[model samples]
Target: MKIASKLYRTGAFLAILLSSAGFTSCEKSLEEEAKTFINPDDFFTNETQCIQAVNGVYQTLYSIYSSPDYWRMVDLGTDVAYSIDVNSAVQNYEFGSGSNGTGSLWLNAYSGIKNANLVISRVAVAEIDNTIKQRILSEAKFLRALYYFNLSNTFGGVPLWTQEIDINAVSSLSRSSLADVRAQIIQDLTEAEMGLPLSYPSSDIGRVTKGAAQALLAKVYLFGKDWKNAKATALKVVNSGSYSLMTNYDQLFDVNTGFKNNKESIFEVQYLREPTSNTNTRTHSQISYYIPQRDAGKRTYAGVDFGNLVVDGWSVFLPTAKLVSMFEPGDKRKDIVLGFGFRDQKFTRFPKPGYPWFGSKFWDLNANGQSSGKNLYLLRYADVLLMLSEAENELGNTAESIRWMNMIRVRAGLPELAASTTRAEITNKIFNERAIEFVGEFQRRFDLNRWGKLIEAAKSVAVDNPVGAAKVKPFHQYYPIAQEEIIKNPNLEQNEGY
Candidate 1:
């Protein structure tokens, strides 16, 4: 163990060719590609070099989101989501170890963890100014926590690799308990909170900040049923005066460049696409996943013009009929969040007879061919408000819960819940509100899982999505580990029911 565990024999992290995410005018955006074959000890000598390594860590996000099954796993198979062209086994809750969806998520998450590990391990000893080194390490730790958060949620408990692992000895490592994983996540985030800055300059706007760490930690606590801490952390973000809901829900998702990292966004995965620039190849076709396809070619489409959106769509995802009906009568978020009818001011043909929906929030007005530069929102202030409501409700603070829930409700033009409502009813209200609010933002499955209603939520939509609902099973809340990983390391045990 000791012999092979010496400094990176594979030099995997040192071989990284870093590329920057395009977020308006980011300092990292101008980074030139690094040559391969650099010595690991020779790296991390300066601020610029440390940033370049961390930028590589951010690049893994593009890999994760660019996975073909990313959306299907996150949002496309639950009660709120229905699949037509999405062929991922998730539609039927029939995942296997070989599932591309599972493998992609696992691989990208671990890849990100590896990148973050390199930054954390090396930058800590980089001999730079203590302040600069700590901030850079903080950014890396925040990212590491996020990737592990995604892993533990999806896989239950995975092999927890905190420090840089030796490539030669990696196969011998085994899974850690879920509790251990959670402890490490909490530890990483706690350190991140103290090290991260309150805000960043324009060139570094999308980088993780103090609020992002706090917001994510709040969610982690909320999901773990640590209501007291969750409530406190959520309230901190709310009063931090750093974020607020956009006056119009439509403003949150539209193609306006001004809204990419708006005040409502606490943390968002930044993406950019130029009509002609394929230099980075980070531009993706997530915009094409749900926008209705063209008139002449694709199998599904809407009857009326959707504001001249020019993109080919797979039309794989749609809101379940049940989800569409769940919206309250005056809720303003419905139209912006779901695509069901004519986008023109006058409602045209309903997409009912054949098609029921196309995800409207993902529509990119400037889509070129099949690609668009829409950023994925991971955390928003609206989510913070709702998390607070859930935490408060759990603690029997129904008044405070309803007050926060009403903030979201009133923003969507729906009447507030009655103060006399029961705590159980408040729970349901928060669940439904979050379901409808985050339609295309990739969070429903996690929410359903955390609430212990994944199977129930699937069964609820049986009438509308019978084929999908029929396959729902309790074990699907956590996907099975990839078979390939187990084959490579016999020490790895498969999750139950796979």
Candidate 2:
């Protein structure tokens, strides 16, 4: 799950605002060039234009994650993974009094939310074809809900803005009650599910689908501890037949394969290597940053050579020893999940001595020494399965719980967990599995917090790492709301103990 951070700079938000305003005019001009330009009020006169507008919404979604603060902060803040020295400031918890707090995950998520709001507000009033208009609005709603889901999870109750709010008119906004925020999220997702199609054509694979909406709704319900609703929505996705678990677990993240379009993927941040069309290319795909070999010649696009891995400076993400130990011995997923090694112990098979980073499997080390970029998978079928098992166990459905848990374990080449397993036992197993499965995919902190184990976990592990010992406090569970935001919005009360 993504979190909010102070990292969103005012300049970046201003840039987006200017760009969106400019696009409105550019779009008008382009339409006129082809004798297709309609009046501002008349622009959404047809389905094609409305659909194009919806595509713009997705474009915004794609751009948000590419920001440095969002991915970096999320990867480092979590417990399942750690960043190496290369990107240590955030990973090492050494984030100082910078313009933004720590990294900028917080600001970027809100920026995405703001952009979604712009789309929803503008598109709703446009005179577009009804079906297309509704669909576009639904997509915007889904994206907005996703952004809020990340925010609510990270910061608890946050300022809930439905339509676009005028910054000048509203200098201060208070955090809404968590209940109210969750209600809005459910409402947005519910609308999205009704409007979205069960699936999309191959060309539209990365766009949000009905299954994606439902899966996300299930997650929202699960986090809110609405067990029945979570179970029901998850089952809807499963029974809809819109997705299936990939036959090979490893294939879900295989760079060579079109992992973004894989069967198991429900929602993914889409990035393309070479773009012939404007819609397909990405500027900040993960492969460019994570791939180790700087001089590897085979290039689909110009890859950034960060010069010899600046061990502490550039290679920021590293796997923690605790995470390494969590993997059961002989588990095939252990190697695939954490690259070739277990903790600091180097693997004789695949060794990189200087910087033993966490996410090696995500690299596309081809025989020709070329690599396809790394695309992050935010939601997948396996996650849903694990969630389903979690909800079932919480609801006291022992048989159903075992069935789901075993499904994932069986796929990972592990024996089925027995039905007699206690809820605590099953929960631990599921949590461990999630850690390994999602290791550097950026999901550790959320898992620990949701399990109510972050403080304890951090303290226990502090014996080896001093930062963990010193910084592990109850308040650390929720990231501090940026001080600037508080000054601007007096309604925003600081989280207790912050």
Candidate 3:
């Protein structure tokens, strides 16, 4: 009944949004039927409709990444983050096909992939401007690659779908090998780079760009252990002259500063609460989940009450003691990353040891005290620098790696590394730097797994928390394919140790 395009909903294409108000337009474009849906024959008649179609792909990211279960899947069971909730706490080390988060992530990714595939397969021949058509197709390709990248990283090898599939007609589907998936992801991103623009106007700010494609490609290479390409691609973004570290580290995550598409961000999912819609939805619950629980009556932290810092929160996602101590001396990032303790980075300290240390990077108070319109960064300039540092070190370019590492170090108020640093030493330093830099961004588990250090890292700190110990296992490296998906497609097999 309603057409919800991802780009159209972010206030980028208000014209398209208004046109979707009528049923005829909705029926002609992206309509989902019970068994067989309408083909793209009538949908790709114009550029506006094509844009509306692509927006549906973007909408899938919100349900995937913004869910509470998604964060729990990545951070809760790791050394840096702990979950107070029982179900979430169990995910730190153990996850199965039944995991709600796994199902949501898989379903959301494929849903996005389906939409992306539709756009890529049909929008090119539309009677739209050649440039606009290519850009739309490029964005669709980038998004499809993103879904596959996440799939491969999480499930090792997932069923690769490049073209739209008819659910009723396709009775069975098989998973692709991880190698094939990685190759396809790389191919998609490389092809996407050509059509993507270097930048966009303020209204079109959230659209994928050349830098975003490169950044994602670099990450894919990093995950695949392609050090040469990883360093090269990451360096491309660093030297592109399009991005820079925010002068103030704290402002990088501050929602109030109007820093949504700042120079540091390569790509981010844009969310809006105003101009709100019911069927075509917009909003996220991250703020309410991340806000620390505190009492206004008792001065527990910073000689102040917790309610003073946030309206209220789920009180989950507490930081581990190991994470608190990992920060280097004189590092400003430590204070910026954690809250509910002797906090000096962005807020007052908690003098009393009453409240758990919660992630403060996404701390934005909303009017309803629930969802906040804070945009989450999928790729940032800081991450590019760190990736380059890691990639160069892996390539045996120790001096070159330190050069990049020092850039992030200097920004966090830490001393620069010596050029004589060893590969082992620089790798550890880079790992620690990323942990501090990207806290509360849900990056730790992936980094550890990619580096082959997840099991060991979990083992080393398992003694600290029995709950964490219960969750950590070698089989936990990749999550199982959701049971629902397996049932829908018998070709789907569960991951090992599930």
Candidate 4:
């Protein structure tokens, strides 16, 4: 069995080149593209080679942000309001056909997982120095864990492929229980924490670090409702003092300052737009895609019509009235966070002449063009603080929960909650704070789910017009397993309630 497994793994590793061809082509054009190649024996022969392979894995991370599959699946579940212009057939929200939004997410996520698995398996057999080998393996494992985390959350139990699997073995795969998937995620993250460095040099700034692993682990624990573990891990991240809330939250997303490595950011999928440099090129920015043409007048790359814009219809993801109303009257975060209306150093609705109703703080109008270099913050210190608060509250540590919540509130220029606050009050406070703090950041859905309020929130957000009533049910909370995956692997079962 072991020998057969090894042979199958080797064959699976070879298949990565073919699978990667479709995904990797969009990023860069390889000079030496080969047909039907199985070169793993030579792929990890040196430190430089190993580093390049690892970088390829990082490139795959970009797909999570740029791919329509990822954005649609994540955005649909969130409170961020969308128009029908985004109606690519891929995003139709169908369950059984395996060609819906959920199906796209499933395929894209596994594509990434397969890439990571190739890196991990190949690096394991390479006779490199132990330290270098360990770190490379750790990076791959961290990425694999991240992919599985998304899968487990969205699809519930999913086929868990650890090592590279042969094309022939693909049909034999079965959906692992959520518990099993979570165990693997924890195991991978624990290994990543031990192997990853506490920090990286300036050149290696975008790479995962010990803090990223710890932060992710904290989030995973929180998602699982393992409060004690979540609290312990989050507190470790906080007390380590490795990160802090950025004094100016605006700077956290600023692209012009080259602020990709800001102190507040724990992990950001780094993107650059200079076409000349492959190292700093990124084509996905929601700001550029969603802003209106009038607001983006004469800005060529600024407005994407997406064929959905009507005379009155907004072009892209617009802030919800509920979301806009959630902000405090004088809160500084209200303007920087939501950009609703013009106020006397306060919040207002969209009445400005040229500015679109849904203006973005992340982008600025430059004479040169509509430049969008904003770092999409995947994890931030403020999230850690909130997770800490949630875990503490769940664990019945009210004082500690209050402390962390207050820390975040004070940073956002809001008053701290009173000591007499009840647990429900604290929970509501955190939810509202998160909504405002992370508007249009693709986090609201996950937050609602973890709090057992996803169905209610989804139903509430559905509307006949862009702003009123649509139907949402509890079954919609978790995306159905893609039908294609089920047909390919008999062991795979559709998620319950799908």
Candidate 5:
């Protein structure tokens, strides 16, 4: 109920960053004074305030990346990831309309959308520098489209809140069709591509760029099964000379505090470890859930040390054996997932050996507290290449498809597809490539669903847990509309089976 309060704001900045709250975006310790209330009239008249307003939109992203529940909703139950507790509702597909599988992502997306709506509407009337105003407006639109993209992917047709709206009247709204939502996303991304810069100065590395909008647009096209557009759009990015595949795979995913915005990054969610003792508040809590918790037993792992210490981590999820087996011999990316070492809370080595699928990409020996300031990748060059491969295959450009896919294979120390590889054969490798390439990135579910391979993926999961596979139903393609949202807005309809 309290989160709904943001939808009512006419548009205002709470001065979200640079607060005692530890909201760090760019390397710069931003200069917004954390204000306490809403009312757009009082804010957005100046560039600084407008900047603060956009930062507020970015703050909601923390809600997605910082929570274990969010991770569970996105990661577990996918074919590549396994639930340590297989009985979990999401892992076994036992959830219903009483709950949408996304955890608090629903509220978070709308919250960001509400803030973006505020910025889009209020900033235009203010007299800021014209170029800055357009860029800011485009940024807000891009973010709004991103939230909608996530919402559409998870829930199918959702209530589209393109701009701010009356909190009391939200109940009057109904779900918009997927086409409408997709169209709006495209329009916003197109404008963002036009208005955003090719790149930013060092201080602004994590902010979205024109290439990001293009890449996202390409993804949106791919998701809609628009092969022609997907191929063309992704090719534009490839030929645009704006990005490249990182030479070293490990460092590319070494998402520690200072490792963001590398050449391969298209869109990255910025995060920072805060000084306060509370680990749950502002920073990403990835390593806590991803790595093994403090253990009393000694581990036989050889790993990078944190201040000469192998700190302990919590174990909530593990990489499915199927995922580990997917990586071919000598594939460099697998090392990034396997064999991690850690100590017990007493700073002593425990008895257990290292575990599989350790959060190597996110681990930081220099964490400020229980959490680390690890940034998350929303889009990267490798993903674009894979999408290109898939799109090219769909459009019957077989040679081009393998060519695109091979770029990734060669980089990973795996051999390229043979020239004689058939389209059907390449299709399977493309799927396998995504599984290996995006391990731990929360991508498998989306890739499977879009490819109409979810049931097949569940079958693959059945190798370990037949019960989880048996629980899958046709309606499982989209999560049910949460019952609470239906209660709050009686006009909102439930997604078909729930």
Candidate 6:
């Protein structure tokens, strides 16, 4: 009950960055006041406040992922998801340094990192029990590492800050090398894995755990092309006995199925449909952008009254036909993942004209368009298994790789591949499997970039939406630094091409 009381107020910490009060060097009175103000140092004196402080960092995640513009930055214009709106800057890849989508994501990520740094730096001497202190510190590290991981992937070696920055020193900071960023991320996650517990009580289900840190470390390794470390860390999670695949694939994202924080979830951004107060970020969550516009009780379509799963959505990101064809003939995941061409025509009443393939992963019958409480999974057990397979094959362990890959395939109701399969074949199979399994989950663009296939994939899917693809060049592997940010900090440089 107390956690609920404090959790809703956690989002108030965002005011540290969002406040409109200008910081000016000429205002000596204000600068002196800022120095004496009771900040995280004075605020986190007790356990309850420490819990609230960490909750603030978690609150930043809602703003990071829930924005429709965020989805446009990551998923839209990719091979798996497309939008027809040529005027949409992000979808069409015509956005320049002034793009708000890129700027918001950049600022939101740093805001989270800044809050986590406050916790990590202040909680050390907070007069709490050693166990509780370690837990809080580990959680902070896990979150900070996550923010940096996303930053490095998106903008490539963004400014790295492990401690709070004074307003006067903000513009002096410059970008760190990618290698340096990766080193810090690995160090933070390694410490997190050591300090985090394997599991928590039901009340603390969404908190980061030992498995989550290890799973994310494995992903970081995979991104850096360190196959040996990637496999080692991934297998650590697989053999840890902490997670298992849910029996039914569809239940993973089905809000009606009561599987929001199931065994498969390693890390998730927790959201609730109903908030305890007006300030709570729980009610701020939104996944409606994935739904079809007129379908699901929004209006009559194809002369049929399709019932609402969630109403009045924009259907901005529709599934691509190429993604629909990637699934094998007998894979059950296809039916659950894509609602486009099903025999019952569940996703859309008319698939011929719009060819809408809306995501069925996050549906709740009781939801209004914006208040859906579906948790956005950051890491899952299935992703771990697939990554393990990928790392194993890269290290010449084709047999072991197939064994790991088969676990996922068997659960998907498809026949397993042969153990005698070559390394290249198994690697490609795992790649394609990830493409289909995690299509609507915001992993496509990053996956393609890490695999060094972004340019090729964009070209291949050019015909799907020519106007958008024509603007996607090889330089687009990294988004340009926002003009606002560059103007604020002269040290910040734009990526190669605007």
Best-fitting candidate, scored by TM-score: 6
Model 5 segments beyond 4 Å from truth?
1-12, 15-38, 255-258, 274-282, 297-312, 340-355
Give each model's whole-structure lDDT: 0.76, 0.64, 0.73, 0.66, 0.72, 0.75
Per-model TM-score versus the true fold = 0.90, 0.81, 0.87, 0.83, 0.86, 0.90
Tens-digit lDDT track of model 3 for 1-498: 022234545333322332342212334555545233333555678987888777766776776787877777777667777666655534445556676346478877876776677678778778889998988899889989988887787889888767655644333778889999999999999989989999986657788899999999999999889999998898889778999999878888776677788989999877665423322145677766666554455533334444434344566667776677788889877666777443343335331243345655767643234656677889999999999999889889898899989999899898999878899999889778877788777688899998888876666556445665755778788887778778878888888887
lDDT of 6 by residue, 20-93 (tens): 22222335465455633344445778887777778778877777777666677777767787775657776677
Which ten-residue region of model 2 has the weakest summed lDDT?
A: 1-10
All candidates in order of lDDT, best leading:
1, 6, 3, 5, 4, 2
Against the true structure, candidate 5 reaches a TM-score of 0.86
Error of 3 at 233 (Å): 1.2
Q: Determine which window of 10 residues in candidate 1 has minimal summed lDDT.
A: 1-10
Evaluate model 1: give its TM-score. 0.90
Worst 10 residues of 5 by lDDT: 1-10
In model 6, state the lDDT of residue 464: 66
User: For model 3, how big is the CA root-mean-square deviation?
Assistant: 5.2
lDDT of 4 by residue, 212-297 (tens): 99999999999889999998998878887889988876666555565677888888776555433322235455554444443335
Candidate ordering by TM-score (highest first): 6, 1, 3, 5, 4, 2
- The sequence of per-residue lDDT tens digits that candidate 2 reaches over residues 1-498 is 110111111224333333434323234333335233323344445665555555555554445566556666555545554544433544445443243333555665676676677667777877767676777788889988987887877778888888676554334667888889999999999999998888766555667788999999998898789989999999999999878878777687665576556788888876554422323224354544443333234322213332222211233345566677886766767666565443353333211343234444655432122223346677888888988999999999978988998888888888888768888898888878887877655466777777787766655545234465456566666666777777767778877665
- Measured with C-alpha atoms, the lDDT of residue 222 in candidate 4 is 90
Evaluated at residue 477, the lDDT of candidate 1 is 80
| Model 4: how far residue 443 lies from native, Å | 1.8
- List candidate 3 segments past 4 Å from native: 1-39, 92-94, 100-103, 169-171, 274-281, 296-310, 340-356
